[model samples]
Target chain A: AQRVTQPEKLLSVFKGAPVELKCNYSYSGSPELFWYVQYSRQRLQLLLRHISRESIKGFTADLNKGETSFHLKKPFAQEEDSAMYYCAPTPPTNAGKSTFGDGTTLTVKP
Target chain B: SAVISQKPSRDICQRGTSLTIQCQVDSQVTMMFWYRQQPGQSLTLIATANQGSEATYESGFVIDKFPISRPNLTFSTLTVSNMSPEDSSIYLCSGQTGFETQYFGPGTRLLVL
Candidate 1:
Protein backbone atom coordinates (compact mmCIF):
# COMPACT_ATOMS: atom_id res chain seq x y z
CA ALA A 1 0.00 0.00 0.00
CA GLN A 2 1.18 3.49 -0.83
CA ARG A 3 1.13 5.88 2.07
CA VAL A 4 2.26 9.41 2.83
CA THR A 5 3.48 10.40 6.25
CA GLN A 6 3.82 13.88 7.66
CA PRO A 7 5.17 13.46 11.15
CA GLU A 8 4.50 16.97 12.41
CA LYS A 9 0.93 17.99 12.96
CA LEU A 10 2.01 21.54 13.72
CA LEU A 11 5.24 23.43 13.25
CA SER A 12 6.06 26.91 14.53
CA VAL A 13 8.95 29.08 13.48
CA PHE A 14 9.89 32.68 13.98
CA LYS A 15 9.71 34.95 11.02
CA GLY A 16 12.91 34.94 8.97
CA ALA A 17 13.89 31.53 10.24
CA PRO A 18 14.31 28.54 7.99
CA VAL A 19 11.41 26.14 7.73
CA GLU A 20 11.25 22.49 6.85
CA LEU A 21 8.06 20.45 6.70
CA LYS A 22 8.93 16.79 6.72
CA CYS A 23 7.21 14.28 4.42
CA ASN A 24 7.96 10.68 3.71
CA TYR A 25 6.26 8.16 1.48
CA SER A 26 6.19 4.42 1.05
CA TYR A 27 5.64 3.04 -2.42
CA SER A 28 7.16 0.35 -4.56
CA GLY A 29 7.13 2.09 -7.89
CA SER A 30 8.18 5.60 -8.80
CA PRO A 31 5.76 8.17 -7.40
CA GLU A 32 4.76 11.65 -8.40
CA LEU A 33 5.03 13.93 -5.42
CA PHE A 34 3.29 17.26 -4.85
CA TRP A 35 2.93 19.92 -2.23
CA TYR A 36 -0.43 21.59 -1.79
CA VAL A 37 -1.24 24.58 0.35
CA GLN A 38 -4.45 25.98 1.73
CA TYR A 39 -4.38 29.44 3.20
CA SER A 40 -7.15 30.61 5.42
CA ARG A 41 -10.38 31.16 3.47
CA GLN A 42 -8.62 30.23 0.24
CA ARG A 43 -9.00 27.18 -1.95
CA LEU A 44 -6.51 24.38 -1.83
CA GLN A 45 -3.89 25.06 -4.49
CA LEU A 46 -0.95 23.25 -5.87
CA LEU A 47 2.26 24.72 -4.56
CA LEU A 48 4.77 22.64 -6.48
CA ARG A 49 5.33 19.29 -8.13
CA HIS A 50 8.41 17.19 -8.29
CA ILE A 51 8.14 16.81 -12.03
CA SER A 52 8.08 20.55 -12.58
CA ARG A 53 11.10 21.07 -10.37
CA GLU A 54 9.99 24.63 -9.65
CA SER A 55 9.47 26.61 -6.51
CA ILE A 56 6.39 28.60 -5.62
CA LYS A 57 5.95 31.17 -2.85
CA GLY A 58 9.58 30.72 -1.87
CA PHE A 59 9.08 27.06 -1.05
CA THR A 60 10.75 24.14 -2.75
CA ALA A 61 10.70 20.37 -2.35
CA ASP A 62 13.15 17.83 -3.63
CA LEU A 63 12.23 14.20 -4.08
CA ASN A 64 14.74 12.03 -2.29
CA LYS A 65 14.19 8.52 -3.54
CA GLY A 66 16.84 7.02 -1.29
CA GLU A 67 15.21 8.44 1.78
CA THR A 68 11.68 8.05 0.47
CA SER A 69 11.09 11.66 1.42
CA PHE A 70 10.00 14.86 -0.28
CA HIS A 71 10.36 17.48 2.40
CA LEU A 72 9.16 21.03 1.72
CA LYS A 73 11.72 23.68 2.62
CA LYS A 74 12.08 27.42 2.60
CA PRO A 75 15.10 29.53 3.35
CA PHE A 76 13.12 32.10 5.32
CA ALA A 77 9.71 31.90 6.82
CA GLN A 78 7.29 34.80 6.56
CA GLU A 79 4.14 35.42 8.49
CA GLU A 80 2.23 35.15 5.28
CA ASP A 81 3.58 31.65 4.85
CA SER A 82 1.53 30.44 7.78
CA ALA A 83 -0.87 27.91 6.34
CA MET A 84 -1.65 24.21 6.11
CA TYR A 85 0.72 22.18 3.96
CA TYR A 86 -0.06 18.73 2.61
CA CYS A 87 2.23 16.26 0.99
CA ALA A 88 0.65 14.01 -1.59
CA PRO A 89 1.79 11.03 -3.59
CA THR A 90 0.32 9.63 -6.77
CA PRO A 91 1.32 6.33 -8.19
CA PRO A 92 2.55 6.39 -11.76
CA THR A 93 -0.37 4.27 -12.92
CA ASN A 94 -3.14 5.97 -10.97
CA ALA A 95 -3.16 9.48 -12.30
CA GLY A 96 -6.24 10.78 -10.59
CA LYS A 97 -6.02 8.96 -7.27
CA SER A 98 -3.63 10.38 -4.72
CA THR A 99 -2.64 9.66 -1.16
CA PHE A 100 -2.30 12.69 1.07
CA GLY A 101 -0.56 12.91 4.38
CA ASP A 102 -2.05 14.40 7.49
CA GLY A 103 -1.22 18.03 6.83
CA THR A 104 1.22 20.08 8.85
CA THR A 105 0.04 23.46 10.04
CA LEU A 106 2.95 25.85 9.66
CA THR A 107 2.83 28.96 11.75
CA VAL A 108 5.40 31.61 11.02
CA LYS A 109 5.29 33.85 14.05
CA PRO A 110 6.20 37.46 13.83
CA SER B 1 -4.24 23.06 -15.64
CA ALA B 2 -8.01 23.24 -15.50
CA VAL B 3 -10.37 25.68 -13.85
CA ILE B 4 -12.90 24.06 -11.56
CA SER B 5 -15.99 25.44 -9.87
CA GLN B 6 -18.19 24.00 -7.16
CA LYS B 7 -21.71 25.06 -6.28
CA PRO B 8 -23.20 25.74 -2.86
CA SER B 9 -20.02 27.27 -1.50
CA ARG B 10 -21.32 26.84 2.00
CA ASP B 11 -24.44 25.20 3.31
CA ILE B 12 -26.01 24.38 6.67
CA CYS B 13 -28.22 21.35 6.32
CA GLN B 14 -30.52 19.34 8.54
CA ARG B 15 -29.35 15.97 9.74
CA GLY B 16 -31.67 13.68 7.80
CA THR B 17 -31.59 15.63 4.58
CA SER B 18 -29.11 15.51 1.75
CA LEU B 19 -27.01 18.00 -0.18
CA THR B 20 -25.78 17.73 -3.73
CA ILE B 21 -22.50 19.40 -4.60
CA GLN B 22 -21.94 20.25 -8.23
CA CYS B 23 -18.57 20.49 -9.91
CA GLN B 24 -17.88 22.03 -13.29
CA VAL B 25 -14.69 22.34 -15.21
CA ASP B 26 -13.88 25.09 -17.64
CA SER B 27 -12.58 22.62 -20.19
CA GLN B 28 -12.99 18.94 -20.78
CA VAL B 29 -10.77 17.08 -18.36
CA THR B 30 -9.59 13.52 -18.41
CA MET B 31 -10.11 12.92 -14.74
CA MET B 32 -12.39 14.34 -12.04
CA PHE B 33 -12.15 13.51 -8.36
CA TRP B 34 -14.05 14.25 -5.17
CA TYR B 35 -12.30 14.69 -1.84
CA ARG B 36 -13.41 15.34 1.69
CA GLN B 37 -11.49 17.26 4.32
CA GLN B 38 -12.75 16.65 7.80
CA PRO B 39 -12.04 19.30 10.40
CA GLY B 40 -8.32 19.56 11.05
CA GLN B 41 -7.48 16.61 8.79
CA SER B 42 -5.93 16.18 5.40
CA LEU B 43 -7.93 15.64 2.26
CA THR B 44 -9.20 12.11 1.66
CA LEU B 45 -10.22 11.06 -1.77
CA ILE B 46 -13.86 10.07 -1.85
CA ALA B 47 -14.19 8.82 -5.40
CA THR B 48 -13.11 9.15 -8.99
CA ALA B 49 -15.89 10.45 -11.20
CA ASN B 50 -15.23 9.08 -14.61
CA GLN B 51 -17.12 10.14 -17.67
CA GLY B 52 -19.85 7.75 -18.77
CA SER B 53 -19.15 5.27 -16.00
CA GLU B 54 -19.90 4.63 -12.36
CA ALA B 55 -17.67 6.29 -9.79
CA THR B 56 -14.95 4.31 -8.05
CA TYR B 57 -14.93 5.01 -4.35
CA GLU B 58 -12.07 4.78 -1.96
CA SER B 59 -11.85 2.85 1.27
CA GLY B 60 -14.19 4.04 4.05
CA PHE B 61 -16.54 5.49 1.43
CA VAL B 62 -19.52 3.86 -0.20
CA ILE B 63 -21.65 4.52 -3.24
CA ASP B 64 -25.00 4.57 -1.50
CA LYS B 65 -23.95 7.00 1.22
CA PHE B 66 -22.07 9.26 -1.18
CA PRO B 67 -23.52 8.87 -4.62
CA ILE B 68 -21.62 10.49 -7.47
CA SER B 69 -22.54 11.36 -11.00
CA ARG B 70 -20.40 12.24 -14.02
CA PRO B 71 -22.63 12.75 -16.98
CA ASN B 72 -19.97 14.37 -19.14
CA LEU B 73 -16.36 15.24 -19.33
CA THR B 74 -16.61 18.58 -17.58
CA PHE B 75 -19.35 18.10 -15.04
CA SER B 76 -19.84 15.96 -11.94
CA THR B 77 -21.87 15.92 -8.77
CA LEU B 78 -21.48 14.36 -5.35
CA THR B 79 -24.57 13.83 -3.23
CA VAL B 80 -24.19 13.37 0.48
CA SER B 81 -27.18 11.33 1.55
CA ASN B 82 -28.65 11.13 5.01
CA MET B 83 -26.14 13.54 6.41
CA SER B 84 -24.89 13.54 9.98
CA PRO B 85 -22.63 15.73 12.07
CA GLU B 86 -19.73 13.56 10.98
CA ASP B 87 -20.49 14.45 7.38
CA SER B 88 -19.75 18.12 7.93
CA SER B 89 -16.62 18.85 6.03
CA ILE B 90 -15.13 20.71 3.09
CA TYR B 91 -15.89 18.86 -0.13
CA LEU B 92 -13.55 19.65 -2.98
CA CYS B 93 -13.67 18.74 -6.66
CA SER B 94 -10.58 18.50 -8.76
CA GLY B 95 -9.93 18.02 -12.45
CA GLN B 96 -6.79 16.77 -14.04
CA THR B 97 -5.58 16.94 -17.61
CA GLY B 98 -3.07 14.40 -18.91
CA PHE B 99 -1.77 13.22 -15.56
CA GLU B 100 -0.34 16.58 -14.54
CA THR B 101 -1.26 18.52 -11.45
CA GLN B 102 -4.93 18.71 -10.61
CA TYR B 103 -6.86 21.96 -10.41
CA PHE B 104 -9.18 22.25 -7.44
CA GLY B 105 -12.40 24.11 -6.92
CA PRO B 106 -13.04 26.51 -4.06
CA GLY B 107 -14.86 23.66 -2.28
CA THR B 108 -18.32 23.27 -0.77
CA ARG B 109 -18.43 23.60 2.99
CA LEU B 110 -21.21 21.48 4.45
CA LEU B 111 -22.30 21.76 8.04
CA VAL B 112 -24.74 19.08 9.07
CA LEU B 113 -26.85 19.86 12.08
Candidate 2:
Protein backbone atom coordinates (compact mmCIF):
# COMPACT_ATOMS: atom_id res chain seq x y z
CA ALA A 1 0.00 0.00 0.00
CA GLN A 2 1.19 3.51 -0.79
CA ARG A 3 0.62 6.23 1.77
CA VAL A 4 1.64 9.88 2.02
CA THR A 5 1.93 11.78 5.28
CA GLN A 6 2.11 15.52 5.66
CA PRO A 7 2.57 16.25 9.32
CA GLU A 8 1.66 19.92 9.32
CA LYS A 9 -1.90 21.02 8.77
CA LEU A 10 -1.10 24.71 8.80
CA LEU A 11 2.08 26.72 8.48
CA SER A 12 2.65 30.46 8.75
CA VAL A 13 5.77 32.31 7.77
CA PHE A 14 6.89 35.89 7.37
CA LYS A 15 7.56 37.35 3.98
CA GLY A 16 11.09 36.74 2.68
CA ALA A 17 11.57 33.86 5.12
CA PRO A 18 12.32 30.34 4.00
CA VAL A 19 9.50 27.80 3.98
CA GLU A 20 9.54 24.03 4.15
CA LEU A 21 6.58 21.68 3.98
CA LYS A 22 7.47 18.15 5.10
CA CYS A 23 6.20 15.10 3.28
CA ASN A 24 6.94 11.42 3.80
CA TYR A 25 5.76 8.36 1.95
CA SER A 26 5.72 4.61 2.44
CA TYR A 27 6.05 2.60 -0.74
CA SER A 28 7.94 -0.56 -1.55
CA GLY A 29 8.97 0.34 -5.08
CA SER A 30 10.65 3.37 -6.52
CA PRO A 31 8.18 6.18 -5.92
CA GLU A 32 7.22 9.19 -8.02
CA LEU A 33 6.39 12.21 -5.94
CA PHE A 34 4.60 15.45 -6.77
CA TRP A 35 3.59 18.68 -5.08
CA TYR A 36 0.19 20.15 -5.92
CA VAL A 37 -1.07 23.59 -5.08
CA GLN A 38 -4.61 24.92 -4.87
CA TYR A 39 -5.18 28.60 -4.49
CA SER A 40 -8.32 30.12 -3.09
CA ARG A 41 -11.22 29.59 -5.50
CA GLN A 42 -8.83 27.97 -7.96
CA ARG A 43 -8.35 24.41 -9.17
CA LEU A 44 -5.56 22.21 -8.02
CA GLN A 45 -2.45 22.41 -10.19
CA LEU A 46 0.86 20.66 -10.23
CA LEU A 47 3.67 22.64 -8.71
CA LEU A 48 6.59 20.29 -9.24
CA ARG A 49 7.58 16.67 -9.66
CA HIS A 50 10.59 14.74 -8.49
CA ILE A 51 11.28 13.41 -11.95
CA SER A 52 11.56 16.89 -13.41
CA ARG A 53 14.40 17.93 -11.14
CA GLU A 54 13.43 21.54 -11.72
CA SER A 55 12.17 24.43 -9.68
CA ILE A 56 8.98 26.41 -10.20
CA LYS A 57 8.07 29.72 -8.58
CA GLY A 58 11.31 29.38 -6.62
CA PHE A 59 10.00 26.17 -5.05
CA THR A 60 11.90 22.89 -5.27
CA ALA A 61 11.65 19.44 -3.75
CA ASP A 62 14.31 16.78 -3.63
CA LEU A 63 13.36 13.17 -3.17
CA ASN A 64 15.32 11.70 -0.29
CA LYS A 65 15.10 8.02 -0.94
CA GLY A 66 16.88 7.10 2.28
CA GLU A 67 14.48 9.16 4.33
CA THR A 68 11.49 8.26 2.14
CA SER A 69 10.69 11.95 2.10
CA PHE A 70 10.10 14.59 -0.58
CA HIS A 71 9.74 17.90 1.17
CA LEU A 72 8.82 21.08 -0.70
CA LYS A 73 11.00 24.08 -0.04
CA LYS A 74 11.22 27.68 -1.06
CA PRO A 75 14.06 30.05 -0.48
CA PHE A 76 11.78 32.97 0.37
CA ALA A 77 8.07 33.15 0.98
CA GLN A 78 5.75 35.61 -0.68
CA GLU A 79 2.17 36.60 0.06
CA GLU A 80 1.09 35.28 -3.34
CA ASP A 81 2.53 31.88 -2.42
CA SER A 82 -0.08 31.30 0.22
CA ALA A 83 -2.21 28.30 -0.70
CA MET A 84 -2.97 24.68 0.12
CA TYR A 85 -0.16 22.30 -0.69
CA TYR A 86 -0.63 18.59 -1.16
CA CYS A 87 1.97 15.87 -1.41
CA ALA A 88 1.15 12.85 -3.52
CA PRO A 89 2.78 9.55 -4.37
CA THR A 90 1.91 7.69 -7.52
CA PRO A 91 1.36 3.98 -7.22
CA PRO A 92 3.91 1.94 -9.17
CA THR A 93 1.28 -0.34 -10.63
CA ASN A 94 -1.57 2.07 -11.31
CA ALA A 95 -0.54 4.91 -13.56
CA GLY A 96 -3.50 7.07 -12.68
CA LYS A 97 -3.97 6.39 -9.00
CA SER A 98 -2.14 8.54 -6.48
CA THR A 99 -2.13 8.58 -2.70
CA PHE A 100 -2.37 12.11 -1.33
CA GLY A 101 -1.58 13.49 2.09
CA ASP A 102 -3.73 15.89 4.02
CA GLY A 103 -2.83 19.31 2.67
CA THR A 104 -1.01 22.06 4.53
CA THR A 105 -2.35 25.57 4.36
CA LEU A 106 0.54 27.98 3.93
CA THR A 107 0.03 31.58 5.00
CA VAL A 108 2.72 34.07 4.16
CA LYS A 109 2.41 37.10 6.38
CA PRO A 110 3.51 40.44 5.09
CA SER B 1 -1.02 17.24 -20.33
CA ALA B 2 -4.66 16.92 -21.20
CA VAL B 3 -7.25 19.66 -20.94
CA ILE B 4 -10.10 18.20 -18.92
CA SER B 5 -13.46 19.83 -18.29
CA GLN B 6 -16.18 18.95 -15.81
CA LYS B 7 -19.78 20.10 -16.06
CA PRO B 8 -22.00 21.49 -13.32
CA SER B 9 -19.08 23.23 -11.62
CA ARG B 10 -21.26 23.26 -8.49
CA ASP B 11 -24.68 22.24 -7.34
CA ILE B 12 -26.89 22.06 -4.28
CA CYS B 13 -28.83 18.84 -4.18
CA GLN B 14 -31.48 17.43 -1.88
CA ARG B 15 -30.99 14.19 -0.06
CA GLY B 16 -32.22 11.02 -1.78
CA THR B 17 -31.63 12.55 -5.21
CA SER B 18 -28.77 11.72 -7.52
CA LEU B 19 -26.33 13.89 -9.43
CA THR B 20 -24.24 12.84 -12.40
CA ILE B 21 -21.03 14.67 -13.10
CA GLN B 22 -19.54 14.69 -16.58
CA CYS B 23 -15.90 14.83 -17.55
CA GLN B 24 -14.56 15.61 -21.02
CA VAL B 25 -11.02 15.67 -22.25
CA ASP B 26 -9.52 17.49 -25.19
CA SER B 27 -7.43 14.57 -26.37
CA GLN B 28 -7.57 10.81 -26.07
CA VAL B 29 -6.24 9.44 -22.84
CA THR B 30 -5.57 5.94 -21.66
CA MET B 31 -6.46 6.38 -18.01
CA MET B 32 -9.19 8.47 -16.38
CA PHE B 33 -9.69 8.57 -12.64
CA TRP B 34 -12.33 10.01 -10.32
CA TYR B 35 -11.51 11.42 -6.93
CA ARG B 36 -13.36 12.93 -4.00
CA GLN B 37 -12.18 15.68 -1.70
CA GLN B 38 -14.15 16.35 1.42
CA PRO B 39 -13.93 19.79 2.95
CA GLY B 40 -10.39 20.43 4.16
CA GLN B 41 -9.42 16.81 3.48
CA SER B 42 -7.06 15.07 1.13
CA LEU B 43 -8.05 13.72 -2.23
CA THR B 44 -9.42 10.16 -2.27
CA LEU B 45 -9.38 8.00 -5.37
CA ILE B 46 -12.88 6.77 -6.02
CA ALA B 47 -12.46 4.73 -9.20
CA THR B 48 -10.62 4.24 -12.47
CA ALA B 49 -12.75 4.76 -15.52
CA ASN B 50 -11.68 2.51 -18.35
CA GLN B 51 -12.82 3.06 -21.88
CA GLY B 52 -15.40 0.58 -23.15
CA SER B 53 -15.42 -1.31 -19.87
CA GLU B 54 -16.67 -1.04 -16.33
CA ALA B 55 -14.92 1.25 -13.88
CA THR B 56 -12.62 -0.20 -11.23
CA TYR B 57 -13.49 1.16 -7.79
CA GLU B 58 -11.34 1.48 -4.75
CA SER B 59 -11.74 -0.53 -1.54
CA GLY B 60 -14.07 1.82 0.31
CA PHE B 61 -16.12 2.62 -2.82
CA VAL B 62 -18.62 0.46 -4.67
CA ILE B 63 -19.91 0.48 -8.24
CA ASP B 64 -23.54 0.69 -7.20
CA LYS B 65 -23.09 3.73 -5.04
CA PHE B 66 -20.85 5.58 -7.43
CA PRO B 67 -21.58 4.43 -10.94
CA ILE B 68 -19.13 5.44 -13.64
CA SER B 69 -19.07 5.16 -17.39
CA ARG B 70 -16.30 5.71 -19.91
CA PRO B 71 -17.77 5.29 -23.35
CA ASN B 72 -14.71 6.65 -25.10
CA LEU B 73 -11.20 7.81 -24.42
CA THR B 74 -12.12 11.46 -24.22
CA PHE B 75 -15.22 11.35 -22.04
CA SER B 76 -16.55 9.83 -18.82
CA THR B 77 -19.29 10.37 -16.25
CA LEU B 78 -19.67 9.66 -12.56
CA THR B 79 -23.08 9.33 -10.93
CA VAL B 80 -23.57 9.61 -7.20
CA SER B 81 -26.65 7.61 -6.34
CA ASN B 82 -28.91 8.12 -3.35
CA MET B 83 -27.13 11.20 -2.19
CA SER B 84 -26.92 12.16 1.48
CA PRO B 85 -25.37 14.99 3.39
CA GLU B 86 -22.25 12.94 3.79
CA ASP B 87 -21.91 12.71 0.02
CA SER B 88 -21.28 16.41 -0.33
CA SER B 89 -17.77 16.89 -1.63
CA ILE B 90 -15.67 18.14 -4.51
CA TYR B 91 -15.46 15.55 -7.28
CA LEU B 92 -12.57 15.77 -9.69
CA CYS B 93 -11.57 13.87 -12.79
CA SER B 94 -8.03 13.33 -13.90
CA GLY B 95 -6.45 11.81 -16.97
CA GLN B 96 -3.01 10.50 -17.77
CA THR B 97 -1.71 10.80 -21.31
CA GLY B 98 0.78 7.95 -21.20
CA PHE B 99 2.81 9.98 -18.79
CA GLU B 100 3.65 9.83 -15.14
CA THR B 101 1.99 13.18 -14.46
CA GLN B 102 -1.76 13.37 -14.38
CA TYR B 103 -3.78 16.47 -15.27
CA PHE B 104 -6.96 17.34 -13.43
CA GLY B 105 -10.31 18.95 -14.16
CA PRO B 106 -11.69 21.95 -12.36
CA GLY B 107 -13.95 19.68 -10.29
CA THR B 108 -17.61 19.62 -9.40
CA ARG B 109 -18.64 20.80 -5.98
CA LEU B 110 -21.75 19.05 -4.67
CA LEU B 111 -23.59 20.17 -1.60
CA VAL B 112 -26.18 17.69 -0.41
CA LEU B 113 -28.80 18.87 2.02
TM-score per model over all chains: 0.96, 0.96
Candidate 2: RMSD over Cα atoms?
A: 1.3
Candidate achieving the largest DockQ: 1
Where does model 2 exceed 4 Å of error? A92-96
**Against the unseen true structure, what C-alpha lDDT does each candidate score?**
0.91, 0.91
User: What is candidate 1's lDDT per residue for B1-113, written digit by digit as tens?
Assistant: 78899998999999999999999999988789999987667988999997888999998999999999999999999999999999999999999777657789999999999
Residue pairs in clash, model 1: none
TM-score, structure 1 vs. true? 0.96
DockQ-based class of model 2: medium
Kindly report the fnat of each predicted structure, to 2 decimals.
0.55, 0.47
Model 2 has a clash total of 0
User: Per-prediction DockQ scores?
Assistant: 0.61, 0.57
Cα lDDT of model 1 by residue, A9-103, tens digit = 99999999999999999987887898989898888889999998888988999889999999999999999999999998876553546788999
What is the lDDT for B20 in model 1?
97
Model 1 residue B103 CA deviation (Å) reads 1.2
